[model samples]
Target: MSKKVIHKANTRGHANHGWLDSHHTFSFARYYNPERMNFGLLRVLNDDIVAPGMGFGAHPHDNMEIISIPLSGELAHQDSTGNKKVIKTNDVQIMSAGSGLTHSEFNNSKTDQVNFLQIWVFPKEQDITPRYEQKTFNPADRQNKLQTVVGPEKDAENIWINQDAWFTLGSLKTGFSEDYKLHKTGNGVYAFVLEGEVEIDGEKLSKRDGMGISDTENVSIKASSDAELLLMEIPMR
Candidate 1:
């Protein structure tokens, strides 16, 4: 494994397009800040809140891996590859914009607002065929343990990506603790807390807080209260 490098970034971006409010945890296109460009293979992490009946128009992408995790409310996704679906809380969606693809996302409801997380990762290779997939994950599966949601195998019971990485989600009760082993020897884990509090490798993470740890076989997490979290293991240089 590579040495661990922790990034405790402050909320660094604000972009309001009237209907969409986005917060950038890392620098993104046209919103570049060299120090916040990316971490390892993890490229983008955006917290988005969309107004009712509003969303992104069709946009094009290529050679990138995109993921959407709804925190609350619902999202309607449509792509050129003939995928049209509504994804809600506890649901995960992945789009491999390989070669090229166009898609649009909208808030599916006309009343309540929508909130979600959008993540982007660099692909191992370029120019493959574009694909789209979404799945509803039972929150119960993560009540007291980590539930693997994305890996490198379709037969692994979840979405698969073309990288030596794994994504897990968990919910812990007060005083609960869990340990996670690295999926690959040279990979690392990025722990992102969605709610409540937790301590990882002695570092405290509150809601929306994250930490990256590597060079270890496993890392420990202890919740101070009921908490929801996402752990992503990806290759490091």
Candidate 2:
């Protein structure tokens, strides 16, 4: 049997700073909920919208696997590793803050606001060499199929992270369906609804809603409508 945990879109922690509005799916910054600290090794899932001409200043992170995905507009990124680039839609970025690093992300468009997801997962090992990687995914490739965007295995076409995790994205037409198989036995899967509607396992999820399930080999995803979804399989311990 499979167990599930749910996070409703409206129940997430929210913070608006005039220039930036953020929603935390899990406990983040000043938003603390002991029960919502994390889902297995998946620590932070933040939905952020940065206003035009406004962004976050440089900050520090260490021993965390950071992944950034832009949903709209452009996000300008800079880091102490000397990696500076602008990421737009379909672009996924990973930063291994092994030992330590300072980074900043800003809205690249002076007129258009930027909306993105900033995720944090605890690394399997600590104090290794800091690194960064970014890849562009074709939306067509994910049409009706799960596209492997981040995983432990290095891919010529897909991006990989430093942890024992697998991340997939899918865009489905109305009434379409799919099954996502877990890569590791002890890993739990987090299904995040990006847009439209879907049913994961047996739970219906709308935009920004999330569900976590574990102790299973595969999860069923059926699109109730045209949908964009993200699946993350992460270690339980």
Candidate 3:
């Protein structure tokens, strides 16, 4: 049997600070829900929209695998490691805050708001060398299919992370269905709907809804309409 939990879009914690609007899927900052603390090694999932020319100042982090996926507009990134870049939609960025690092992100466009997802995962090991990587993926590659964006492997395609985890994105047409097998045993999959509607193993989810499924080897996904989906597979232990 599989264990599952659903987090409806409206149930997420919301914070509006004029320049930054954020939604938390787990306990973060001022949001405190003991039951919604984490999904295995996946610690944070934040959906954020930043006003043009506004962004987060420098902040420090250590011993964590952080990932950013821009949904729309452009995000300017700067880190203590001397990396500066602009990421737009279809780009995936990962930062391994192994020992320690300070970074900040801002909306690159002065006339447009930037929307992105910020994710944090607990590292497999602590206190190593910090690193940063960013890649732009072709949207057509995920059309009616899943595209691996980040994983634990070193390759020209996917960005590497400090944990035994894989992040995949899917762009599905209405009536499309697919089976997503677990990359490793004992790993769980968290499916987050980015747009449209989807049904995962018979459970329906709308835009921004999240579902954590564990104790299972695979999952069946069907699109009720044209949809964008994000799947994060991480170790449960």
* Root-mean-square deviation (CA) per prediction: 1.6, 0.8, 0.7
Q: Report the Cα lDDT for residue 158, model 1.
A: 85
Please write out the lDDT profile of model 2 over residues 1-237, one tens digit for every residue: 988999999999999999999999999999999999999999999999999989999999999999999999999999999999999999999999999999999999999999999999999989979999998999999999889899888764678788899899999999887788888899999999999999998799999999999999999989999999999999988
Q: Which stretches in model 2 have alpha-carbon errors above 4 Å? A: none
Clashes of each: 0, 0, 0
Candidate 2 lDDT trough over 10 residues, lowest sum: 153-162
Give the C-alpha miss distance for residue 55 in model 1, angstroms.
0.6
Instruction: Kindly report which residue stretches of model 3 are placed more than 4 angstroms away from their true locations once superposed.
Output: none
Off by over 4 Å in 1: 1-10
Per-residue lDDT of 1-237 in model 1, one digit per residue for the tens? 435555553555778888988888788756777877777798888889999999999999999889999999999999999999999998999999999999999999999899999999888779989998888899899998989998888687889886777999998999988778787887888888889988987788888887878788898889988999889888875
- If both were scored by lDDT, which would come out higher, candidate 2 or candidate 3? 3
RMSD of 1: 1.6
Which is superior by TM-score, 1 or 3?
3
Residue 236 Cα positional deviation in candidate 3, in Å, after optimal superposition: 1.0
Sort all candidates by lDDT, best to worst: 3, 2, 1
Question: Where is model 3 poorest over a 10-residue stretch in terms of lDDT?
Answer: 153-162
lDDT of 3 at 205: 100
